[model samples]
Every structure is written in structure tokens, then in C-alpha cells.
Target: MKKDIILAGVGGQGILSIAAIIGQAALNQNLHIKQAEVHGMSQRGGDVQSNLRICSEPIHSDLISLGRADAIISLEPMEALRYIPYLSPEGWIVVNSVPYINIPNYPEIERLDAEFAKMPHVISFDVDAIAREHGGVRTVNMVLLGAASLILDIEDTKLEEAIGDIFGRKGDKVVEMNVNAFRAGREAGKKQMKG
Candidate 1:
């Protein structure tokens, strides 16, 4: 099996962390993984994106071409929309429902919402809020990972293991916190799938 994923968000939103976890999980499963990251002005809250390709066979390219992505997992709503051209017709979008309005000319919420409403497969929720409730703002990335879990080829236990491995050095508390965030996000994603 193969999956092409685009992970997007503004700089410092922890999109890279999400990519790392996914990569680690894929590696654990003995899958070939290739990733390409664009860190445009990341330190200044600029656009940050990563293209991750995981497959049972060798991957020749690091980039995901237009309309070839199996899923787009974004930490910001607008960032998700920015990659629409990379989404396949049946691809899923797992994005935060909340907007990160750093620019004065950010598009209106209604326009963004209307566009998202047109997507046949979209899983969006207040991930930041969920993270805040779970373990403060630090867990937002984990929340996003959790939401994208449903679409991931890896098993849930593998993801949980990846989270533990990624945050293990930080201490048990941190690991537990992220695990909770992931599970909470997964539940939210499941609800979105049902409704």
C-alpha cells in the first residue's frame, strides 16, 4: 500500500512534529518513506509544508504532485485550503476547524467555510481547543495526528508507540499527555466520520 500526505501549517505550529511521528510510524512498519519540507519563513509564522510518501515499494520522488495526495493533514484551516490542487478527487482533508489569522488580509471565515463545505471528504474540528483542554497548547499537533489516524495505514497502537518514542525522552508525563491528545483527537475524528 502507498499513501501520499501533505502536512501543512504556519511556522511554529508543530507541523514538522506531526511529519516526524508519521515518518517514524511508517519506518516502524518497514515501509519506504520519503519526505520533502518547505519551510518558507517558518520562524515568522510563514507557510510550512511537508510532503510525505509512504509505500511498500521504493519511492523515487520526495514530492507529491498535483492531485496525487491521498490526504492533506493541516494544522491550520487556511493552510489546508492552500493545498487543494494537491488533493486527489477522493482524498480526505483532516484540518483544524479554527483559523490562524496572522495577516490583516486573511480571507473571511464564511468564504473559507463555504469552500470547505463543498469538499466531500473533510474532517475538521477545533483541534487547538481540544489540545488546550487536554494538555494545554503543546498538544495541538498531537490532536491533529489523532484526527488523521483514521486515514493512516498504520495501526493505532503503532501511532501510540510512535508518540511515546517521540516524546519519551521528555518524560512519562509528556508522553502520557500526547497520548491523551491523540486519543481525544481520534475520538473527534470518529465523530466527524459518523456525522
Candidate 2:
């Protein structure tokens, strides 16, 4: 099995954390993994993206060429669109519908929605709101990861275990909150797939 995923979001949206969790889960399953990241002006709310590749066989490169990504897991809608050129024809995009609105010239929501609607394999939703309902805004990344998990070819229990391992240092409460957010996102993803 092989999965090439592009994770996009602004810095501080926990893009790295999502990468970490998925990376850990891949390792837990004895999969080969390669990752590359770009933290453009992250401190200034700039774009942050990561290329994560997982496979049963060995990987030779950290980068994923254009039109080869199996999935794009984004914490922001605009960021999700920004990486469309990198997604494969049959790839899935699991993204949060909320806009970060960091730029003055950000595109209109209607236009963005229309573009997303044209896609055949897209799971777009208000992950921020879901995170809030489960935990808080901090868990937004986990929520997105949860949605993406359905197509990630990794077991959900492994992802949940990785979450626990990552947040274990912070204590049980933090871990529980994140796990709850992940489950909520997973349920939402199921509904999105059905409808």
C-alpha cells in the first residue's frame, strides 16, 4: 500500500502536529515514510505545507511530484485549493471549510465553494466548528486528520493510539479531548461520504 498526502494550512494551525501523528501511526504499522515541509512565513500566519508519503515498500524521496498525491488534508479551504495541482486524478481532498482570512485579497466564499463543488472526491466541512463542539479550536487539525483517516489506509485505532502517544506528555485530559475531536471528525466524514 502507498499513500502520498499533502497537508496544507497556515502555521500554528497544527499542520506539523498532524504530520507527526500520521507519521507515528505509519511507523507503528511498520510502513516506510518520507516527509518534506515548507514553513513559509509561518510566524506571520503564512502558508505551511508538508508532503507525507507512506508505503509498505521503501521510499526514495521526500517530495511528491505534481499530480501524484493520493490525498490533500488541509486545515483551511484556500490552502486546500492551493495544492490542487499536486493532487492525483483520483485523489481525495479532506479540508476544513472555514476561512482563515489572513489575506486582504482572499477569494469570496461562494467562488471557493463553487470550485470545491466541481471536484468529484472532496470532503469539505466546518472542521473548526466540529473541533469546538468536541474540544476547541486547538483540536481543529486533529479533526481534519480524522476525516482524512478514512482514506488514509491506516487503521483508525492506530491513529487514535498515535494521538494518545503524542499528547500523553500533556496529560489524559488533553489526549481525551483530541481523541474525541478525531472521532467526531471521523463520524462527520462518514456522513459526508454517504451524502
Candidate 3:
């Protein structure tokens, strides 16, 4: 199976971290993977996106074509909307409902909600709030990963292990915190999927 994903968020939101964890999990499964990152003005809170393609077969390109993505995992709600053109007809959009308002003319929350409401395959929630309540605000990215995990072909344990490996250098406490955050997000995702 092939999973073409677009990971989107503002700078410092750990969008790249999510891509790394997924990429590592794919590698653990011996799957072919390609990744292309656009860090355009990321340090200035500008749009940051990564194209991740994982498949059982060989992949020749690193970029996901327009309207061909299987999923768009976003750490920011507005950032998710920015990539709508990349989503396939049946693609899943796992995004945080919280808006990172760094822009001067950010749209109203109600309007954003209305837009997301129109999508048939959207999993939108205040995942950042969930992460903040569980661990710290820093684990929001992992929370998003946990949400994305529900749609990923990778096993939960593998993703957890990848999280451990990625955050190991920070110490066991940090690793455990992120794992808990991931679990919280996963549970939320499952609940969202059911409802």
C-alpha cells in the first residue's frame, strides 16, 4: 500500500518532527519512503509543509502530486486548509482545531469551523489543548501524530518506539511525556472517528 501524506503547520510547531517519526516508522517496516520539505520562512512563522510518501513498492518522487495525498496531518487548523488542494477525494485530514494566529488578518474561528465542517473526511479537534492538559504545550506535535496514527498503516507500538527513539536524547521523562501525549491524541482520534 502507498500512503502519500502532507504534514503542515507553522514554524516551530513540530510539523517536521511528525514527519520524522512517521518516516522512521516506515523505515522500520522496510518500506520505501520519500520526503520533500518546504521550509519557506519557517522561522518567521510562515507556512511549513512536508510531503511524505511511503509505499511497499519503489517510489521515484519525493513530492505528492496535487489532489493525490492520502492524508494531511496538520498541527494548525489554518495550515490544514492551506493544503486542501493536495488532498485526494477520500483523503483524511487530521488537524488541530486550535488556530495559531500569527497573521494580521486571520479568519474567524467560526468561519474556519464552517469550512472544515464541509469536508467529509476531517478529524478536527483541539488537540493542542489536549496535549497541554496532559503533559505540556510542547507535546502538541506528538498529539497530532497520535491522531494521524489512526489513519496510518504503521502499528501503534512502532510509532511509540519511534517516539521514544526521537526524544530519547531529551531523557526518559520527556520520552514518557510524549508517549502519553500520543496516547491521549490516539484515544481522541478513535473517539472522533466513531462519532
Per-residue lDDT of candidate 3, residues 49-149 (tens digit): 89999999999988999999999999888889999999998899999988999889999999888888888888888897888777878888888889889
* TM-scores of all candidate predictions against the true structure: 0.96, 0.96, 0.95
lDDT of 2 by residue, 131-161 (tens): 9898788889888888988999899999999
Relative to the unseen true structure, what is the C-alpha lDDT of residue 165 in candidate 3, on a scale of 0 to 100? Answer: 82
> How many pairs collide in each candidate, listed in order?
0, 0, 0
Candidate 1 similarity to native, TM-score: 0.96
Could you tell me which residue pairs clash in candidate 3?
none
Ranking by lDDT: 1, 2, 3
lDDT of 2: 0.90
lDDT of 1 at 9: 91
lDDT of each: 0.91, 0.90, 0.89
Comparison by lDDT, 2 against 3, better one: 2
Tens-place lDDT digits, model 1, residues 9-84: 9887878899999999988889999999875456578988999999999999889999999999998899999999
Candidate 1 lDDT score relative to the true structure: 0.91
Better of 2 and 3 by TM-score: 2
